[model samples]
Target: MSTLAIDKRTLRQDTWWLEPMLVVLGLGAFAVYSTWAALQNGNYYAAPYLSPFYSPCLAINCEHVSVPLFGSWYNWSPAILILWIPGGFRLTCYYYRKAYYRSFFWSPPACAVRDAASGYSGETRFPFILQNIHRYFFWASLPILAFLWWDAIIAFNFGGSFGIGLGTLVLIANAALLSLYSFSCHSCRHLCGGGLNSFKTAPGRYKAWGIITKLNEKHMQIAWTSLVWVGLTDVYVRLLAHGVIQDLRFI
Candidate 1:
């Protein structure tokens, strides 16, 4: 519990800063890799498998995961256009906000620890207020998740024939993990049951909200798992695209 006492005090403990340091390293590494991957347009898709970065491939030049719906009028990386949805959603996520706030900003880094900044204004100002748009991102992510599910299903086929391969399994796991992450989101919880006046009125939605609420309890775990799996999915597809590794088949 925070006290109103004006005392220049700090937690007398070992490893207080460890959590923040790990957060910095983890987030920084992911940022660098995602930026590098997004710039590589042609390298994103492998035959019958699409990197999440380039799912619903909109460019005409998409050779592997070729949908080409918008027509290739502009010569630009497709990720720049599509990455914003999930990127924005995760950026504004309530869990992530607490994460970066402590890790990057050192704002009261740990319980009973003082914030590094002396004077602070809360999220009512400038860009901090932008987080209120998270729910909108949650809305946008629904369609994107549908698209990803479609892509994962599409991965099971090779040359118009039903088949199974290592990539198929990877894509399946990636989609499943990501779905769990989204379902477990706090916004999703609210959408399901937060506004309800009485659970006795809506049995179906109430049941769903109950399940989602359980997922919400493990939100942090799902969030990190999805993050790691996404990167792994991209790496597996990249290797296949480059012929660095071949997809192993079963059935």
Candidate 2:
């Protein structure tokens, strides 16, 4: 029998509820934690700088942004807000697609399944088929990263006022996060080398792509590392804003 067949047999024999349940639990925990953290740091409501940029309409009022954990307070943003959406998107990435589908979608093990069981064989659908959206997201995120880098610069200019002046550590963390997210994207990998049929024909492009592939191979590791560090960077900013964290400057 093939390896996929063995995996399918094992999956069939395994308990289905455990993986799905764990997915729910994990998502729930992250939602709760993120909501609580935002509320605690006064981010649930619009920041002073953000208010002038966008007005709160009745339907999209910021006050409606709250997650129901213990008692539902006006938590500021919905649990499914933009901050949390990225997590869901990343969880569904091509590299993570199989692991997450099995856990969240209860997909059968593809390696063991034969004849249209590899998870890719399906009627094309919207949103679920929206994994292709990452290509757009990859390009879009670059501009956001540029703004983040600018924010870091402003933080330095103000000498870290109102917690806006992020420290060097935070700056480094931000750069690392941007690098990991940008470099690990599937679109970037494809642009690097996946599209090329023959390296000998396009030696220059092939060499450049070869370098990018090395980076892409470690994409998952970079993704997780950057995720953790970016969260910490936000925490640092919040702590400084609230006067709970201090920036140590020398010279």
Candidate 3:
């Protein structure tokens, strides 16, 4: 009976569900706000009057802008939204596999409880199996970063005849967000660390890995910061496009 009590305590300690639940709820709220902001800016499709060149849409509210074909006419903002779905999942995703088995899918723990007189059965159930996805997502986000950079350049073109566009500021914000995302990724740290095989053997690779590990140690904070910044980047572009916000130009 005493051994069973100890086993239950261990199981409870390993399966934490609250943290991930909060993260999901928070991200959902942000998604709703971002969508509303995008619609308000006439960015649900495209506005050539707001941005002359590189407009994703040929006409406003046109059927030509299809989600399956081009994925919404608004350029950078939509990209940000798409990236965010996986981004949120990657954050605090380590517990997903564990929580799923212990709390919902599998219910009872996989290991058998035994007294000291008998041998203990090891835990056969897998924990953190879903976290393997983070590796793939880390690599996938890199190209998205490049696309965002390109969009930032186009966003700078101001619609009016004379004034320089506010796209540069938007570009800078996107760059910052990309930096945060790249730095905090788990797979990026492994890549920086010199892949799986040479991570410990190569001296130079080890040094790089150490640096990235240090950054990844603060992954939670960086994740939240990047998440908020990316959302703000979308809103900023939308506001500028809609003439709700003005970008100040020095030169």
Candidate 4:
């Protein structure tokens, strides 16, 4: 079995590097925006509307916060407490594993491309071994998704009055997008369909599995859409909270 002795890095003809490079820029920009927004602490709450980045505001300093579970002792942004669940989920996601591995790690940046590293250890190492807990992260994210939905519902309550506003719609859309991304996860598919030997035994599970499978097919698109929408939702709330913009009321 003699292979070609070509010494070049890759024989790919098309622009394979373009995809990974774009991924780098997209994820990098998101990291910058999310970091800045999370640390601001202020301008995350605007009355009936709260930024998705700081929902379930746990700190006493959080404005209009319902829970205040962390209390005043816990200073800094409350987003620090909440973001980690979703962050860990996305970090350990199967799709994201491929994305960052190619873009950030540059390990076989594209199809048929040479790996950046000389050797391969896979995810058996200390930090990479942690990826195995992705299913746990998925479980943890379920409650967070519930909270986001609660936030969207509360956005309709304006000081005890039912009102519809642009911010309310934004929060609703944000929650919906995140729901799509979360439910479309591979872990969710496994939970719905895995470990089943006979689909005839559990028709309900089979139906749910079919639905999740359809969603999973578009997981990448949903993931990116949800990520961008969350950032935008935060910006919308920040502007309104800072008095830079006023909420457009429809009802």
For TM-score, the strongest prediction is 4
Residue 205 lDDT, candidate 2, scale 0-100? 77
- Whole-model alpha-carbon lDDT for candidate 3: 0.51
- Name the 10 consecutive residues with the lowest summed lDDT in model 4: 1-10
Residue-by-residue lDDT tens digits, candidate 3, 54-86: 123333343223224343454443333353544
lDDT of 2 at 165: 26
Candidate numbers, best TM-score first, in rank order: 4, 1, 2, 3
| lDDT of candidate 2 over 141-203, digit per residue (tens) | 565465456544444444335443236546656665766767677778787777989888888
Model 2 ranges with Cα > 4 A deviation? 1-31, 35-92, 108-123, 160-166
Ranking by lDDT: 4, 1, 2, 3
- Against the hidden reference, what TM-scores do the models get? 0.93, 0.62, 0.56, 0.96
User: Model 4: C-alpha RMSD to truth?
Assistant: 1.6
Answer with 2 or 4, whichever has the higher lDDT.
Answer: 4
Model 3 TM: 0.56
Question: Using lDDT as the measure, which candidate wins?
Answer: 4
Q: Report lDDT (CA) for all predictions.
A: 0.85, 0.52, 0.51, 0.90
Give the Å shift of residue 234 in candidate 1.
0.4
**Between candidates 2 and 3, the lDDT winner:** 2
* TM-score, cand. 2: 0.62
Task: Kindly list the per-residue Cα lDDT of model 1 for residues 64-86, writing each as its tens digit.
Answer: 53456666575778877788998
